[model samples]
Target: MYDDRERDTGTGRLITGLTWTLLLFALWLWGRGLTGVPHGTDGPATGDLFALTPAQAARLPRPAEPLGSALPQRVDIPQLGVQAPVVSRGLDARGAVDPPPFDQPGVVGWYGAGTAPGAKGAALLVGHVDTVTRPAVFYKLSTLKPGNTVRVVRSDGRVAQFTIDDVSVLPRAGFDARQAYGPRRAGRAELRLITCGGTFDRASSSYTANVVVSAYLTGTTR
Candidate 1:
């Protein structure tokens, strides 16, 4: 992992990470899937898929219980040379994972109320692919390949290292929420990085598809 965890953590303010006291409300929203980041890119057809290396199917032991809400301070994708501050995000009034303000498009927002990084379940990290002016934090997220490492430094002092397992681009109109957002397997620490990809329909001012990168925890450090 990069050696700029603490340094970068201090550089940006996090989007407020809040707990889901309204579990019922949050669950209803989760069913809607976490969709918020928008990028301005004129990609291929909606159903057109980008080829990715097959993921090495494997598994790992997970903690018997959830880690004590270890809030992520920063996320680093070594292969992509990315280091961005992470903030916690809760559901919007519409029950979707709200994106960080466009002005701070470089910042990433973790679903604070969901599975914390390193915990058993899917932890979400979302960032914009592009902003009103230029490319954003996860602009090149689709280029990430299997085995590429994503290191997330949490507030609890442990660094969770996740290995890319799969990448998918699906049409937003017929997206399978449970299939896309569901955990790859039970009882494992996993991470999902999401951003807008595919064609940017100027007619609607939104992308026609989404890029989802899935990863699983392989190791950690203090």
Candidate 2:
């Protein structure tokens, strides 16, 4: 006697398991690549590494005369119902954004070396979907769509709102280093939200692609 229902359930479970295994594998690969540790590393090089067009550079935030001491401390997306605190830090030697506290699953991380949110240029914020054990802050970031709103709370008590323009997924190796980190339209502020995605590679322990969400300033609150 062939049991169709039993067979279908078994097949479904197999597919789900397979998907998880593949995701783990992709993540492994991504982690391995980031750990190569560049030799003769210069501590945080300045200037435009992307050779941005003059027009693009004009849109980005201008460098502060003394560089502001305060940075963003929180992020809120009313549409997604996400309101996570943000931690400020520089990149690690491995060229990967550092992970935040595992317990704080909804926190956003700001790249302190680059433009601050609300500044003329683009600001970068990164979060992890998972940290080996559990899902982290940005697990739902992929759900954001165009026209969604994201708000940033800076340490100085200023709030900035950005409207989502686009979301994209790029292979880890194919990520646009310039566009992702470069300046934005003249006099307009921009933000980038990044996280791991695509299939996970267990052998490498990292995601195959990075999910990026780009947004532009739409409003501000004093």
Candidate 3:
């Protein structure tokens, strides 16, 4: 989520395109930095970090095999009570993934040039944490814990079921695009739901940190 003076705080600074071979090098050289969200309002002031205990991790379901490429239609996070439409998004002139339009705060933007949801790679999804006047689709994203489920309905008549494995609030100062957007395990289908977190800096019109929720494919349904 880039700055929208009249709408959302600075958010959505995800990597653009699937040219990981070269983008990885570029990000390593100069990590991407994102702006912060607002503070003390109806939105989250900072992201909540949740780590899984060894036993809890062991209790999670095993990873499911990856599916063929298909466009994501909607994303549902049961724990957050979120059911949002997914829209295709491309990179801006600055080479960063553009977020959903400010007017469509409830919509989630998917990186069209990258891996599709349910595919064998990390599919990037971003949303606004809050608008100037109220909380948006991802306002409660940080509250999600490991093992929560995320379901993505794809255009190919399949629903990809993912189990949350990691939730972290990464600082913009040294944002690691590869680590954040890359698949946790090779050949696994991964998903990242991202939004703004941390204190918003009025001067910079951005949030100090980004909330990144990582999940891996665990099941599938029609």
RMSD of each: 9.4, 19.9, 9.0
* TM-score for candidate 1: 0.75
State the lDDT of candidate 3 residue by residue for 1-222, as single tens digits.
211211223332222333664444432222233433454533344444777789998999999999988989999999989999999987665666677877788999987767789988788888888777678899888888898999999999999999999988876676666787688898798999988777777877777777889999999999
Full ranking by TM-score? 3, 1, 2
Point to the candidate with the largest lDDT. 3
Query: Each prediction's TM-score against the native?
Result: 0.75, 0.66, 0.82
Better structure of 1 and 3 per lDDT: 3
Give me the overall lDDT of model 2.
Answer: 0.61
**Candidate with the greatest TM-score versus the true structure:** 3
- Supply candidate 1's per-residue lDDT for 20: 27
- The C-alpha stretches of model 1 lying farther than 4 A from their native spots are 1-68
Off by over 4 Å in 2: 1-70
Q: Give the TM-score of candidate 3.
A: 0.82
Every candidate's lDDT = 0.69, 0.61, 0.77
